[model samples]
Target: MKDTVLNILVDLTGSDEVKKDLDVNLFETGLLDSMGTVQLLLELESECGVDAPVSEFERSEWDTPNKIIAKVEAMTNEL
Candidate 1:
């Protein structure tokens, strides 16, 4: 899951700077902006088969690869 999210981030940002050990804040890293965030959530929802509300979109949820995995896992569990 982490690898998958990492791949997505890399593809979106055109950067290989994401590391498994590094704490990455997508916004701070400039890997994601407001528009990118929407696109990412949509992709995640499609890929994970989960619906994420825009209101649930939070910076903490997208802070790092691990957090992304956690968010998806939680959303999947809810379904």
Candidate 2:
């Protein structure tokens, strides 16, 4: 799951370093933006089958890879 999430982040951000730093602030560091987050959510749904709705995405909840993985795992379990 971590590898998948890391891969997704790398692909979306075009940054290899993101895979190494799971806790980095993607937005604050300029690695991601609002539009990127939306694209990421869509990618998560399509690639991982984690359908996180845009309405429920809090920046704090989905900021880093660890948090995103937790969210996706929780959502996947609920499915």
Q: Which ranges of candidate 2 are over 4 A from the true structure?
A: none
| Model 2 per-residue lDDT tens digits across residues 45-73 | 88898878879899988788878888888
Local distance difference test scores for all models = 0.74, 0.86
Measured against the true structure, the TM-scores of the candidates, in listed sequence, are 0.80, 0.92
Model 2 C-alpha RMSD vs. true structure (Å) is 1.0
- Show how many residue pairs clash in every candidate, following the order shown: 0, 0
Candidate 2 local accuracy as lDDT? 0.86
Q: Show the colliding residue pairs in model 2.
A: none
What does candidate 1 score on TM?
A: 0.80
Compare the candidates by TM-score and give the number of the best one. Answer: 2
Q: Which segments of candidate 1 are over 4 A away from where they belong?
A: 19-22
Model 1 clash count equals 0
